[model samples]
Target: MNKCVGTTEAASLLGISSRRLRQLLEKGRVRGAYKTGKFWIIPLFNHLPQITKGTRGPKGKWRTSRPPALAKINVNRNHIGSNIKKSPKDRKPVISVKRKGTNLYGNEVEILGPCKIVYQPDNPLDCGARLWIDLRSRYANETFSDIHFIGGSFPATR
Candidate 1:
């Protein structure tokens, strides 16, 4: 099992596409690698029978908890998910906002002409919710610099 093969040879030996082979190697699923200046080398462990596709590990895709937080970065301000404006003949401009739980990193923001409030949830509960506006242009030096509550209050927790 000490055969050293190129990426192409490794792909052919596994009867899989080169992309897939590379993925397996990167993920540590296969027992081979491309040394700094040598071909892909297969270790003795690789001689074992291949694991059939679709086999689940102990957790089986269901996570008991959420992922970790991202590296701290500057705040963003500009595209704030502010209230929508609506024009009326007998009434003032209507404003609508919402607050809800989200599945991704941050809350989901949606705004219509101006009617009702919209809410979205955040992924990691520890980081709490935040109002991020893309401040890449107007504030050339500042990447992010705005924070508002779902209820439009400072230090507001939803």
Candidate 2:
């Protein structure tokens, strides 16, 4: 029979923590290691098992696969509001609006743009749609009773 040592002695010899040795023993990563009574018996001559390093978390299709393409939005002229018309001639040069907020992924996101949607990703993981509106716009500063959309009107915020 091979000479065996306790987990503490084996951990010290292997230059690792006793708790880490216990984990390795439990996972069957430690060679010539076995449980006896309430303690672990590791062979004295055994070395630390080779551990392959790769991506830390679980492997899934999201790691190797590309995100889906963004859906194209076709704007109908009849559905557009008179005030909110999409005319290149009526478009004005506005200052960039910057806002800092947290995304659904709990990441700190800083958005900078004019009075329109700044970024619309090709494929969104959390929310499919992201509308960025500048609060410094002329209409934003004015006190409006209701805000008009393409389909309906919404209550304005104070």
Candidate 3:
């Protein structure tokens, strides 16, 4: 199907921000779009033009890499330096867990522990982040989709 759409509509169809689409149009990057009467009309059924070299206009104004005045920020890395550190006489292996998201009942949920961020695909949409805890926990790698709500048989997990 062949169709011409306005800038914002084309951007929505392309899954990109409208301003970024306009920037592409202004830079002559969008393949099947043209400026007509001060408006860029984009053709449907065409791939969004790639951002090429020099498409971005003049460089942003120069600024210091760091703020002029700042306090010392302490970033704690827990498990990263495990090999280098000396251990106590005897200590238990602490199980650290981080969690997010509310139960099916719409209550707020939280978890406290050391933090390590990793990217994973198949994450659920239409909700907060999915939580992955120790394998033994009842809610390991649980998201809203995993909650079984058949006939209200089971109480919500908090």
Candidate 4:
């Protein structure tokens, strides 16, 4: 459906930052609307530039160019190795995310990660999560990719 999406919503939908989205609008690559004192809105057009979901936005202009092949890297999400039982005073599950990796541009990416939702009491399953490392390379041949959460019973909560 063609909906008039707000700047922030459009950015989230395209998986690009709001700043990047504004730049694209400024370049006239993707059409958008802005008032004197209001938020910019991107019209849902039929022929908008297709940015792959979760792929980082191009740095400068939106040109017709392909990206390079990114090397296949394996992401491992391990548990604490040792399960620690919470004392009677402390009552909370122990499952935290540990994310660390590099982007296509070799930028250091690290995050504390999100906490898992407890469906049942004290379910100590380490629900693995995958985060897409964004590359800051403006080159036309930089490998743009997304993180795929695999190997876990529960789906990774974004």
Candidate 5:
């Protein structure tokens, strides 16, 4: 007659947890395992039972069909700026600085005048570069690379 053992001893011999062995018995994965009353009787076999890998739950409907296509968006690059316009209340007030002192390069610097603050999303240096390029293009005869800021009390915009 073959020897039999409880779940605990059987799990120890099989190098698995008692709960896992109980689950295996419940799922009929273990060949010689049976439930007697509240306890389980597992036959002591020389080799461990082979448990094949399979999907955990019921098959998904997604496997049989393709996913829905996303809606396509048409965006015009030039008009993108128009959509990002902020109301006058939400805008940052322009900073006004009086030009007086010479910069480190010894070039006389001056604030041309207060201008509307230009919004540049990602890189702040790009905004400065864009302004410099604009100034260079506008006043082709004048040099603007040495323009520097001088200290002054700026009045807040009402």
Candidate 6:
């Protein structure tokens, strides 16, 4: 039941900008903000900056989950996903499969395990679906690493 804004309205209400809210208020991380004279007095937080759990998107590897066996670090011959060029037995590293997609909270998902594939490529929108195995069942974790579909003949369980 409290509020307090300034410093560019608390960095535009936490959308973050005003010089990153003055570097999070000089690294004090706002909280109750202070510093008068030149103004800073910020303290409006209806929830915005906590975002933990692997720190999602922008290369933090999103929720992680992707590198279970990107071809076990490619033992030698390369090529997998997009940029097609298959060799090492038609390359395959990039696991986690459970089908029926839509995760990250959009719900309607149906993969009881694994799911991590990504090869985005859309010239105005290709449609082969370019890989993108998908995960997010809370970062699905059954100890992962199926060794590229275990002893071959895949079938971890439909």
In model 4, the worst 10-residue window by lDDT is: 103-112
lDDT of 2 by residue, 1-158 (tens): 55677888666655567887787678776666778899987774323233223345553111122122111121222223442665754432221211122112111223232224334466432434333332223332211122222323222211
Q: How close is candidate 6 to the true structure, as a TM-score?
A: 0.18
Q: For model 4, name the residue pairs that clash.
A: none
Listed per model in order, the count of residue pairs whose N, CA or C atoms clash below 3 Å is 15, 0, 0, 0, 0, 3
| Alpha-carbon runs more than 4 Å astray in model 4 | 32-36, 46-158
> For residues 22-111, could you state the per-residue lDDT of candidate 4 as single tens digits?
766665556445434566656654423343233364454432243333423223322222224544334322222232433221112222
Compared with the true structure, the alpha-carbon lDDT of candidate 4 equals: 0.40
What are the models' TM-scores?
Answer: 0.26, 0.29, 0.30, 0.28, 0.31, 0.18
lDDT of 5 at 117: 29
In angstroms, give how far residue 103 of model 4 lies from its true place: 33
Best by lDDT: 5
Instruction: Flag clash pairs in model 5.
Output: none
Q: Give the residue spans of candidate 6 off by over 4 A.
A: 1-120, 123-130, 137-148, 152-158
Model 3: lowest-lDDT 10 consecutive positions: 66-75
Can you write out model 5's per-residue Cα lDDT over 80-137, one digit (the tens) per residue? 3543586644443232222332112111234352223233445534223232222322
**C-alpha positional error of residue 37 in candidate 6 after TM-score superposition, expressed in Å:** 60
- TM-score of structure candidate 4: 0.28
Clashes of 1: 15
Model 2 TM-score (2 dp) = 0.29
Alpha-carbon RMSD, candidate 2: 20.5
